[model samples]
Target: MHKILVTGGAGFIGSNLSEELLRRNYKVRCLDNFATGHFKNIESLLANPNFELIVGDIRNIEDCQKAVDGVDYVLHEAALGSVPRSIKDPIMSNSVNVGGFLNMLVASRDAKVKRFIYAASSSTYGDSKTLPKVEDVIGKPLSPYAITKYVNELYADVFSKTYGLECIGLRYFNVFGRRQDPNGAYAAVIPLFVKQFMNHESPVINGDGEYSRDFTYVDNVIQMNILAMTTSNSDALNTVYNTAYGERTTLNQLVHSLKEILAEFDPEIGNVDIKYGSNRAGDIPHSLASIDKAKNLLGYNPEYSLRKGLEEAIKWYWENI
Candidate 1:
């Protein structure tokens, strides 16, 4: 069986990825410090014979090396996410997202992992006015969080060119779906909105409700990771691809869709008030991705649209916390 290492394996995306990888017959080792990740996500997986859990910080060099030992591939997803969170504590964001990421990269290279795939964010697009963000051209980093992700890409590129480490970066745009925690102050828009609508409370729109996003689903991210790790093409190596739905939806439309769908569970949900507030500091006005590269290169055909993903997310939020 192929062996794989997943950093941040207890977080939202990492947990889902680990499950999918194990289901596909890969031996999986999950490494997490449980800083932002939760043990509950991997509790059942610990029972599986194919899965091993390493409770250690990515910041520690020895921990990183031990996790990567005997693994064939590395899925690097451990990071302090959220722009506002990074804005509040840039040093914390940098330490994990940038510092820890480097540790994993060096360890993976030493372990001779076939491929190193890490999560990149649309925040790297920063202030670019372009409607659909492209890889070659990018704007300045808006927040400290964006800078760390961009630096990951840079270091990955250098590693590939210098040490022949094979790496692929997936630039995620507004990723939201099941297992996305909603209790934190830096909680994403979708889960936070779902939590509010679940309790018949008013949902707050950060801006005028005109701000938009690609809002890619987690399943699509899973597909991209699997495809990127298993691909045979040489040109596809050492590059970045946008993992998104390739369609944009405004916050107003999103809120209305959530309210309408949640009404199925409670009719009172339809009447939930939506409050408006000032736009966020680092928020981009509009975000849409050009997934053409991913389509042609990685066989990444997104199976879920925003509406489809929202339905699944609403169902999960309704069932889970």
Candidate 2:
């Protein structure tokens, strides 16, 4: 059986990917520092015989080397996310996102892993007014976080060419699902809105509610990662693919859908009001992904639409939160 190392495997996306990997009977080793990840996210997987947890930070090259040792594949997911947070502290973000990412690439190359898959960001498409963002076209990064993710792609490319390390980057677009923390200052919109609506508080929209996103579900992301890791096609290697549902939902439509979905569990949630505020800095007006590359190359067929994924997410939040 193939053994895979997942960095930041205690975070929301990391934990979910680890769980799915374990379910598929892959030997999984999880490395996390708990900087932004929580143990509770991976608590249930501790008892699994195939699952191992390494308490370490990707910022440390030693930790990265240890995690990649004896691993066939590496999934690098450790990074400080959030544009505002990066804006507030670009140094720390750079240290973890860019510095830590370089560490992983080096470790993975040295370990001679079969493949290295990583979480790229749609924010890399920053400041571009292009609709249905294709892979090759990009604009100047709008924030430090965007710059860091874009740098990851460049570093991975260099590593692939220089060291002959096989690498694939999955550019995630607004991923959300079970275990997404809703209480943090940098909480994503879907979970944050669900938490506020559950508490009967007004959920705020940052703009005039016209900002749209290709809000991908976590399952689709997992599928993309697996495909990236296991694909035998040589042409698909050493590149990036957009991991999205290929559909857009406006903030207004999103709130309305959230209310409609949550109302089923508690009718009172339906009446919760939404408030609008000034647009957030570093945010694009519209964000959508063209998943044709992923579909054609990786056979990526996203299983969840926005509503479908939201339903699953709400169910998990309702029971857990």
What digit string (tens of lDDT, one per residue) describes model 2 on residues 1-321? 999999999999999999999999999999999988999999999999999999998888999999999999999899999999999999999999999999999988888999999999999999888999999999999999999999999999999999999999999999999999998799999999999999999999998999899999999999999999999999899999999999999999999999999999999998888999999999978999999999888888999999999999999999999
Task: Give candidate 1's total backbone clashes.
Answer: 0
TM-score of each candidate structure, all chains considered together: 0.99, 0.99
Local distance difference test, candidate 1: 0.92
- Give the Å error, residue 313, model 1: 1.4
Going through the candidates in the order shown, the clash numbers are 0, 0
- Model 1 residue 183 distance off true place after TM-score fit, in angstroms: 0.8
lDDT of 1 at 24: 94
Worst 10 residues of 2 by lDDT: 105-114
lDDT of each: 0.92, 0.95
In model 1, which regions exceed 4 Å deviation? Answer: none
Give the 10-residue window scoring lowest on summed lDDT in candidate 1: 131-140
Q: How does candidate 1 fare on TM-score?
A: 0.99
